[model samples]
Target chain A: MSKLCFVTTGATAPFTALIEAILSRPSLDALLECHVTHAFVQYGTAKDVYETSAKAAREYLRQQGKETQLEIDGMDFDSSGLREQFKLVQDTKGLVVSHAGSGSILEALRFQVPLIVVPNTVLLDNHQEELAMAMDRQNYLIHGNISNLAPAIKASEEFRNKMSQFPPVTAGKERQTKSFARIMDETVGFTDFNNE
Target chain B: MLPACPALYTTTFLLATLATLLVAATLRLLTILPHTRSTPPPPRRRPGTLTRVLIVLGSGGHTHEMLALLRDLDPRRYTHRTWVVSSGDAFSASRAVAFETALAEKASRDTGEGKEEAGRWHVGPQYYTVVEIPRARRVHQSLLTTPVSAVHTLLRSLTLLYRSEGLPDLILTNGPGTACIVVLAVLVLKFFDLRGAQSRGKCKTVYVESFARVRGLSFSGKLVGRFVDRLVVQWEGLEGVSGGRAEYWGVLV
Candidate 1:
């Protein structure tokens, strides 16, 4: 079982769940491998959930007398180097979970990794809830509500199996491009190719 | 009636001829004044400079070009905030991810919706308009929630009705399709005070002409270029398009 879970959070993520997951790492020490990243702190954001999660994880490691090997660091997310982080996730042979940002999700998809998304909806009331609910509409994501995250991550048969699939077929749409060309030709109609 | 005054007749004829000629000359001068001066005044320097600008992205390659220019702004002096007025196409999710920017995508019937409504699926003004009704909008909300409702919603719904209301300031339009609208929006609010309209818009419009010509002479650029306060040609070559009429501040995003 490839059981490494790496999370790099933005200013907004499900921090309480992260704290809970990280704090309870010892309990699952024998069952799974965990790598929790606490990156949300550096960016002038201090939510109780993220702080608690980071603190709990640190305390748990200290109690167990084990060195904390989880990669927790500050990052400038708006920089170009952010792409390398996704590339790292791609190379890792394990379950992948990312906070819902179109970039991350798209990257995960490009790498063909099974991705579980925890939307930034905890910060606001938005259509993300609907998107999370509509997972079956397209095989893009498995919503990270967190309650089912452990089970889903441990055995996300749907996403795990479909990792090799390409994005939904867009074959017929090419004809539309041709039709669009026809309309353009009809309107502007005359072309002097010898404008050169 | 009293005596045949030959001197008086000649004097009267001369005076009448002079008066007629003077009147004709004055009337002719009046007609030419409006046309000769109708080229609009030369663009003037705006008060206060922009440090951060939020540009809304539209269909085709406009969104792509916008995302590309966003890569060039200095983070200290300017923060380029972008929101794509997008739809649920296969491209949206990928492009949104690629740009690493938040998208305000909604179920617009087509590109026309953004021209007048808050946020809709309409990709560009070339293809869409605002035709939303309450019942239809409710159905839209029920079916799709991705299309966001921001200040843009009210601005769009009320644009033509109260076009002089609160609208964005200094909209830096770079797309070929949305030119007429940017001009209309800028000119409409130019008469009245609105958000970002008077100051940033002292006709302060930023455009990259090479990026703009998706097909040919961007219709929207040509149209809106007439009124936008500052028309920025990203390339030195395109400075001619403004034809010495618009003020060129080198390459502006």
Candidate 2:
């Protein structure tokens, strides 16, 4: 099986700009040739709009005599199913392009997948952009806008290398979990109780 | 001349009253003086026991943060865990269930036993219960109706708590509007018990302010600040602003 690339826009918002940029002819040709054998795009709360865009992209690809290899969903996958998809990403040594929501970024990072984060500009407060930039600064991922989608994909080679040095997000979770347990033990007076 | 017996009785009574007054004043001063000293005695230690922990999860970011904290808690230490969320938040509920499943899988993996033993771990309800109550204030809900919704939520929370096998030993929250109702429910129960009613186990509240609140406390954090057993802020600067009640615990998320 060919390598996979997963793209998601979270559950609540639409990132059509990211979707459009990724499905643009040049990006598709580059991805098909150099990167992924299959692509899964989860459009999230903007199903109808994304479906229309996906149809147009497919038609354009067919007219250009290029084989279509994209699977698009209007919304997110089921919880269990999404977990399996992440597992696929890990298994295939694939990449992820995601909106800069903390949950999405962290989940992708947990699998140690090379990531490209495009902040949805429509979001309030520029929070997503800030998060994306910070992660980029740490060399954990490539941060870009929809305008520079192809270059960000090109940067994935560097991102994959940087990922080896970057610690798995699960390590942080495990450490925090241990500290939290200790706090609970101390707070609840369980230390002495456990000894007995 | 007055009768000698009457005069003697009157004098004895006067002297006794004066002596009693002086002794009472001295005792009061003795008790009050110790507190006036600069250094206070260390707080008494509470007896620790396996606790029932109730974790309140808000949608999205709040739920994610709480999950990270929960992952760190030793499951054996908290014999019973209950997750509370607002009604209509199916995402949080699903995530809670998924986390429990993953935990069970991890436990089985650690045992390194046969399939039969792993099946044993999977048997029975996992260590947690998810309880959903009406939101205190729905998005775009009328301000006038908010109190009604809040009261409804409090009543539901109280019932949920009462129906549980035992009162929660502790309640953990991370700045959600729904948490206010749960905290209120606990306080209301405590209030009734205080008035010579049936005793419910003392349920302590620990509110961890979200890490995003760098400059100030969120509205829910501010509301529960005075009431929670511990107000934990992740940022050091917040301690000064929280009237010294908020303890800086470093970043939890």
Candidate 3:
């Protein structure tokens, strides 16, 4: 089984750009040898378009004499099944190539997985880009555009080394919460009524 | 200044007094005879007892930030915790569950206990509950039906608070449309004695502005910003902009 997993969970919009970029890579044959499981969620994409795209990708693979190992999904899977999908990412223990959604980034970070974030510029706000850049600044993940997907993947080994030394990103430290609680105590007398 | 006509002044004064009295009487009646019958108050907790807390979870970034805020809350201090999420927002619900699970695991690990009981379903000493209520308004949804949905959600939130074994002492939220309705419902419940005598101390509402809104307040934040007991902004720059209502909390998430 290939350890590398490429996830494109574009719940609000289809990330066809990411999928096409991954499939059209010249080094598809090299990746095939790694047995990479290219799991792509074509969320919000029309069924016909997805099918046509997948079929074309498969034909391209056939022409290149490369075996296809692609798991493509439509928009059926949503937030409800996020944990289950994240389990797949963890099980793979490979590099994660994902769209720059906070939820996705957090999940990948939770597992300390080497990640390459590709921001979808088509979104109304550039918030994803911001999140990606911030995470990149933290050395948590490689933030790359779709066009740079190949280089991003190639840099995963180095990214993984950095991730290994980095402590897992938890929700926040206990001190932060304790401080907030103290403020709550003084402002709202939160602890006053609790005494019994 | 004296009115030009004494008769006109007298008539206007009389009418105003009558209207004021009528409104006051109506308000008193509403409180005294609420439509929903109040439940009996729970046994009063002695001083230093556990405080029941209700936290609202908004989807995506809000949920992420809230989880961060909750990460260090002393489980021993807050023994009872209820999480409320908007309907159809399984993402937030799942994140809440995951957070609780992580917290429980960490507690067990810290105490060097539950090692033998690992892999078994072990209910910890803490109490955590997750409840879902309808969304006040759906995105891209028609505004015409927003009032109906908002009212429906408010009613559901009211019922949830009323039915809970104990009413929450504090309600915390990061503003989204759903939090607005939930806060309103809680305020109404407090005013009407819908949650029984245990609701004596009005549940303190805390609204934390989303980290994304560094320059300005979100629409939902703007709506309930003033009404909440405490309005928190992560950025120091927002302090002046919020007219001193928003306390700078630094980066929470």
* Tens digit of per-residue lDDT, candidate 3, span B108-194: 666545333222223253488888998888888799999999999999988888888888877889877889988787667755666
What is candidate 2's CAPRI-style docking category based on DockQ? incorrect
TM-score of chain A of 3: 0.73
Candidate 2's C-alpha runs over 4 A off are A14-17, A25-34, A62-65, A68-76, A146-148, A163-178, A192-196, B1-50, B97-123, B126-128, B162-164, B187-201, B209-219, B222-227, B231-253
Candidate 3 chain A, run of 10 with poorest lDDT: A187-196
In model 1 chain B, the worst 10-residue window by lDDT is B128-137
For each candidate, report its DockQ versus the true two-chain complex: 0.02, 0.15, 0.14
Q: Positional deviation of B206 in candidate 2, in angstroms?
A: 2.8
For all candidates, what are the clash counts?
Answer: 18, 2, 11
Q: After superposition, how far is residue A194 of candidate 2 from its true place, in Å?
A: 9.5
Give candidate 1 regions above 4 Å deviation. A1-4, A11-44, A47-52, A61-78, A121-124, A135-137, A156-158, A164-166, A172-196, B1-253
Error of 3 at B196 (Å): 10
The lDDT leader among the candidates is 2
Scored against the true structure, residue B233 in model 1 reaches a CA lDDT of 48
